[model samples]
Target: MHGLVLAALAVLVSLTAAASLNAATIGKANSTNCVMLIGGEIVQGDFEKFVTIGKLLLPGDDGESTRRNTVCLASSGGSLSEGVKFAKYFYDNGIGTVIDDGQECYSACAIMFMMGTATGAEVSFANRKLHVGGKLGFHRPYLRISPGESIDSSAMQIAYDAAFSSALDLIAVANSKSPWSSQPMMKSDLVQRMLQHVGNDMFMIDTVDKVGRWDIEVFGSSEPSLLSEEQAFYACENSLQWQNGLTKGDITYSNVSDGPNGKRRSQSLSKETRQAVYQVEGLASGYAMESCVISRKKGTIFGCGIDEYSDARLGQGDCDHSNFADRSSSLKAISVFNPATKLEDLRTGQAVVAVQSGAARCFVIKGSQITDNEPCLVIHVGDAKVRGRASTITHFVWPSGSKTVLVQSGTSFEINGVSTGKRTVAERGDCYLNSATLNDFCVLTSPN
Candidate 1:
């Protein structure tokens, strides 16, 4: 039985090697002019054909290489060595890769997808897109040994070494930093997750969390409904915050606008901030809005939520009779009143704290004494209360702070305020504020 098993493994390895030498088909895809599809088993000649196609499509004439040239991949995986070579070529030449809708890329093919890059001024993983309907899976590289095969110690050791080398090469490729952007082509977490699964099984990039954490773009689908967006946003936001060592919790959206056809939209844009609000059903607050703010310059998204009853004018009495009457709060504690809530309940001398810009600073809110002493480029206060709620005579006061000079120096910012100075280091797509001025500010430009 052992002899038969060994013979079977030998035959399987030979057949696999022979099959992997055949060139994969590479040609213009029907979907787009710039997209070339690489289908079937990847092998020896595929890399040459890919380079040929890439050169023909992206001739170095007058910066033509900067054009969008994508290689959409569809394969069950073949030669790992060839895959590494192709991935290196893609990275060096800024060639994008994609798994189109309904297609699949696994193992070696998936490695190529992850290392793909796009030609642009800044480092962007947007080119390595995996369509919502497509599948991208990974697993540890393995030898082509038959199950239950009885192999000699030397042969087994050789196979194990080969697999180990492949894995190390993969890690090296993933950790390689881009010459221009200094960002890793692929994150370590992604590579670690890929190596967790055995050769016979796969760890699929099936969840939205996986896709976002890996920074893989998704397309071929319209924006989800508010409910779905709310859930997905929370999950993604939690993941991002956890990764960044930031706190995570339930967010609030204080302002909401009802659009045509029962849809609600909230948008606010300035030199410093761009905010979008989506109305969603809330179990605790009855009616809620999921608010997301994007740093115009940094491209980081800060999201929170707001409940209908948060508005002070829509107090306990009024909320009990409104559409969200079922979720009306019975509590009488004033401490539960958030910055956007209990506005009408504020007394003559009550002090309330509200976040000015991205949690950069908090100011004391007292009736008609609103001050704008801060040197912020933009200060957005959610004034629009719950939809169709009755107006109130009480007006909410805004906060005031100090003037500051913001200077960008590499990945860090130096803020010189009137009384004190502080420095903040930021990662790409992260929002930060100055502790000196209590001004919310984020880096909008990429590091040089």
Candidate 2:
């Protein structure tokens, strides 16, 4: 980060007496780092200037090890096409981005800032002599709906298509970058939600707390990485805020016991409403955990839901055991199952047999990408490939011919399923099982 700050100062020292470039500016202050300044509204030609300048100032194409690049952007935002181009430049160049004090990085500017992480670039804020308080914002892509005019089906279809295309571009940029270096900038669902969260078309990610929520590695020079493996597991577990209609008191607390070799205690909060929240703390297992919500009234469920399935945080130990979709694979299969009804809704009393999918003998999916495909479930039970989805998997027969059934138990353990007095089914007892999705279930005959 010091190198980044110094690079910024170098840019300030080299700028002309005008004090403002009002356009994308680039210059080389030293042998190791190039400083780029993007100001005003970003539009066409900025990306070309950035690339051409990088090639001119940075010198070698393989300066990845020797040369460091810092980019400072102050803009309101403009043309999504140009924003995409700008992001592509940053992703390709792996240039760091910064927003010093008094600088405004709103809308597309914020999007570009997030894109910086895709390339494993350091992004920060400076508030020293020439800098002001920094601001990073997000909003839905600019919509072209005419004022006071209703959109016809065809026009609405076109808008939806454009928005969908933008989402795909964002996902591609995120997936192209490795999670170890880049970290999760944001989840696909968050992108979709933030794009529609506000009517004014802006969602400012100004506070450190808000920025901490996203899959980001760097926020400011003073701030540390927010999406560490432990932090991500923490985020997955307690990330949900009690919303309207949900009372704070309705959420209860319970202590974890230290008796089990794995000393983890989970506090369950049951609501008069359909949702229930559970907080698991002090998990001893090396496996990571993610918090999930299930509807007691609904008969289906999915672990973590759309908001928690972070593609950017996938390989960062949070979901290391689960296999990922290949890079060349596109989400070609569309799932006919309505996720909410078929997944989120828990059956009246169905047993849940959650299993962790690791490199060893485990359940395999037909497709790697869960977002675009139905991923048919194939479990390796003994020497046979047993076909079953997570929800469809009901019974797990022990090696001794004893069977454990997955019954819908409000708490973690089920009493009626196995007839073993009180057998632990899922939850904190097994971290791998704790994180498994409703459709990711498998029967493990042995730990190996």
Off-target runs (Cα >4 Å) in candidate 2 are 1-34, 59-67, 117-132, 144-167, 179-185, 198-201, 207-209, 217-448
Question: Best by lDDT, which number?
Answer: 1
* Worst-scoring 10-residue span by lDDT in model 2: 327-336
Q: Residues 1-448, candidate 1, lDDT per residue (tens digit)? A: 5654444334221112123444678888766623688888886567888888767665332243433768888887777767888888877677778888678888888888887776655444335877767888887665665568677765565555655666667678877774465557676767777668866478887644455446666665322111223222343233323233222243432222234443322222332222232222332332443222211112222232333333222112222112332322211111111212212222232232332333232221123231221112222222232224321111112211112233333333343422223334343223335454354433322332
User: How well does candidate 2 match the true structure in TM-score terms?
Assistant: 0.39
lDDT of each: 0.48, 0.38
Q: How far is candidate 1 from the true structure (C-alpha RMSD, Å)?
A: 21.9
Runs off by more than 4 Å, candidate 1: 1-22, 58-67, 120-126, 147-153, 178-183, 224-239, 242-448
Q: Residue-wise lDDT of candidate 2 within 259-316, one digit each (tens)?
A: 5553334333343322323333422323433333221223221123222323222112
Residue 187 local lDDT, model 2: 51
> 92, model 2: CA deviation in Å?
2.3
